[model samples]
Target: MRLTELPRTTSFRLALMFLALFGTCSLLLFAFVYWQTVGYMRRDQDEFLQRQLTFYSTLSPADRVQRLREHPRNDPGTRRPSGEFAANGQWLVGNLSVLPAELRQAHQPVDFVLPSAGAPVPFRGYATQLPDGHWLAVSQNVHEPREFEALLLRAMLSAGLLTLLFGLAGAVALGASSMRRIDAITLAIRRIVNGALTERLPVQGGSDDLNRLTREVNGMLDDLERLVHEVKGVCDGIAHDLRTPLTRVLGGLERAQRRASTVEEFRDAAARATEEIAALLKTFNALLRISELEAGARRAGFSDVALAQVLADVVDLYQPLAEEKNLTLQLSGTASPTDITLWGDASLLFDACANLIDNAIKFVPAGGHIEVRLDAEHRAISVTDNGPGIPASERKAVLNRFHRNEPSRSTPGNGLGLSLVAVIAHLHDMKIDITDAAPGCRVSLSWSAR
Candidate 1:
């Protein structure tokens, strides 16, 4: 299968799975709680009746039976007893059917299962047998239970079921809403990859992860836009700069071949063509090098570097070149020696700094001044240069590969210097800015100081 056709990952699916698992666990927990609560409540009621039966056994058996029979009657002193009062606010009591021989032989409070009788409604009962062959029993009717407890259990189970249903629906709804936003952002990112650089993911501004992801994705698009525009400009420059010289060399060679008056002339034309091709090859090689650097494929080779030492060496190497161009180059600024180190590809940083110095020498006129300054700020090493300052409007524009100012349009250099600098800057999380100075331009390179 094509890479793009592979199943896409979704957070909503994972969220839904978790929600389902949570709901299952919650249902099991509710089931356990219901059974446990009902069991405990039943146990407490039965234990209370046992205690009352034991106390009632203290009375004469005849008196106990008389009380049970009269307890449910419509007497003037009719009152509800504590523990096991039925609906209509009365105790359930009556004589049971003939006891089995086993029950009769083992004389104690025994739970009996019997058929229903008139109002007594046979149930599991706890009883006590007196030594005198009389008996007293506390009957727990299965048909009629405590009204409030039964109602409460019913209500709780109903509420739990409703809550489970609503909770599942709410979870699904929330997952759907999040998934919609994510799908929208994914579509926008797909558009960007399809050459729509202006496409940006929407942000909800709630400081959520997706919002942060949107901003980060947009930032990536911006960087891609800059890189793409730079590549296009570089292609344009290769066509403009190389084509003219190559066309000239080709034409000269063709003319010399047509005449053939002297061998030296032919050789000169061929040599010039060879030189033009070599120059073209050099530009191509430089382009490939910059591309490789920008791709960060060689990051494994990076190492810790002394920022101050790198700056000092770069300034020294370019000083003579600056003198030849009739411009003064100087270095200023002091920072702690320990603070001047950075984690980076040292050779690349050196090349980047040298390129800045060369550009300064190339743009500044005779007697113009340039200074290379370095300092540690906010965990970064900064290098600033002074020369014919870049125009404010075109400061960003000049960073594009092959972009040159009107005045420097005729200057003899392909515009890859700053472009290479830009690649290194990005690799090291560095920032480079060209600003207009009082008299000339200033360039600054800032990288995270290790």
Candidate 2:
């Protein structure tokens, strides 16, 4: 599936999880708050009742009885704070206080807690009769019972809904922001594949994973782009240089065929053309070999090759040429070096080392010195030459295809020497460095001991 779709679908599942967790937490909090509030209200009402009873107990017993006798009748149902008295309450109060039939049968004073039925519709109350044939009652109207519970449920539902809404909004905002960055990367990749070799992903200067991945992939793309450009330039140069000689050979043969007074002259011209064609074909073959090595298509042929042996072979092959040019060629290292083995195609490695040595001998003046040194500690091999060293600014460029310095333009060699070495190094997961060697240049090839 598309890259954008992957993240989009994952976010949908994450949102559902976020909602469920937040909703559960909210429900628990609502339950806790409601229990504490309602419970405290009930406890406060009970405490008030205790305080009133204490107040009544402080009165003298004789005064309490006199007040009960003198006070007018106060019906339980119609009593108000204004002390309004009922006209015919004597019998109702006497019967209720003196063990009325309902109380005698139940054998207890009437006590109940329930909502009031009138306009107030209070939460709780209690009713009873005093000892002296007088009715007494206590009631509390702190809140409406059903109405309060209904309102609480509505508020909880509203809060839960609002929480879900805000949570989803935040998730969507974060998801969209991240998606924009991914889209930018995707578009950049598409442009690069479509031949925009110079394209690069925008870096926002963060140390996050996405930024690191972008940087690494962009580095790889940079190498690929340079390789492709180099290949293109080499192909163009080959076509230009070979086309001239090929045209001349064809023209000469055509002229010989028309002007031939005998078969020998025509055959001689045909032989010269064939030789030129063979040279051109050889150059093309070499170019193809380098390309194949760079492409890593020969990786399957890799084996554990002794680095010292490879160096010995290359030095042996080039010593004669170096001596003819009046140059010193030396290969000096431990007889049985440690960590001298490398994993790679033996033939390709030999060819690459030969190219480096050949380039070194060609550039160095007569009687100049060349050495192939091995560093066991560093698992590295170096080919050094006493010549006009390459400038630091041009070291990397020289490793690219068809790159030639102006000073070496007169040299009878193609500029694919170090470039091929670099390709081989990359294929073997090794590193190649062209650095200053005091009055000359040193090319190092290093590999992992593991």
Candidate 3:
């Protein structure tokens, strides 16, 4: 990827955010260290000056003079450490030349300047009033803290520079690695879009967030590829199933136009064409309804549905048709009132069951039997028929729209009954299991309430 594109990636943006946060924390740390250093230095100075004043106040005048004599005398013209001054401002017998004008004759120490040999020095001192109209002052030297501050500042600057450089480099390195992974993901997606349904996003070794996302995306791709194939199959069905019926309609119309001598002959051809058109419309409607149900548009009407009631209703609705064909239609199930109900669209569930029962009635030979069972214990419904059963190999194929088995082609159905059942089951989060029922077929749809 281009350098300019790097910044546009999620990793680079997150790195920039990290850098900002790091800078903020660094500034706060620097401020805290500077404040603490200054406080420590001032505290040490205060304690030293207080001790000197306390010692000076304890001494007798004569002994105090001896102690003042011990103050450093090697540097001539330097300020004294201990001294006595008359109230009239004359230096009595200490190291200082005279009393500092700013040193109040009070117990607390105060800061002042003292003239020395070369440059004037900074000092802090305390003065106490004596019993004999004199002031005893004790002083301590205080070098300028700015010189030490300058040294500390230089050290901090060097360390801070190193930290910034290293942190930024690490951030960039991490961002680059993320970008590489993202690029791989993009390449994989591009290949998929180019008809490579078998392609999948690569998962790196660690189970990081990116890898988890890749795995989820790969799973979605699996479904998408299946749906794409299913759609292709549906398209193929449309071409295969609709073409013959549509051709019949067109051929009837052509025959009516060309070969029919009388109006009655033309009317007969037109009547046959109308029948084919109606069949086409039925198939079309069934496909549309399946799509609509699978899309979940009917879910808004959902409510608690009694499974037993739905099965009973399917039997009643198809009982007459079964009687007309000399077939026995029976509904048998056991359920407590509480256990019989499930959450679903009542109308849709009835329609699905009706379709299943209708298919059984149509497929079973005259005098054959069709059975509908509601298993409340398992949250399932099954329809079984005693006729020509579907082979195990064709069970799955028969669920696709317009897929007619070889023996059932002459039956009057658009071949969408079980396909509609599958769509309804899917919308209701149910599964369909098709199996041979000794003499015929049994198709059961089961639901998981939990």
Q: Find the candidate with the highest TM-score and give its number.
A: 1
Worst 10 contiguous positions by lDDT, candidate 3: 71-80
Candidate 1 regions with alpha-carbon error over 4 angstroms: 1-20, 28-44, 60-125, 138-145, 182-195, 203-220, 255-275, 297-304, 307-309, 335-339, 376-386
lDDT for each residue of candidate 3 in 4-78, tens digit (9 for 90 to 100): 677777777888788879877887798789779977987877787678777877888788777777664743545
lDDT of each model, Cα atoms only? 0.68, 0.70, 0.81
Collision pairs in model 1? 109-127, 379-449, 387-441, 388-441, 389-440, 389-441
**Better by lDDT, candidate 3 or 2:** 3
Model 2 / residue 87 / CA error / Å: 21
Q: How accurate is candidate 3 locally (lDDT)?
A: 0.81
Give the number of colliding residue pairs in candidate 1: 6
Cα RMSD (angstroms) for every candidate in the order listed = 6.5, 7.3, 6.1
Better of 1 and 3 by lDDT: 3
- Tell me the TM-score of each prediction against the true structure: 0.75, 0.69, 0.69
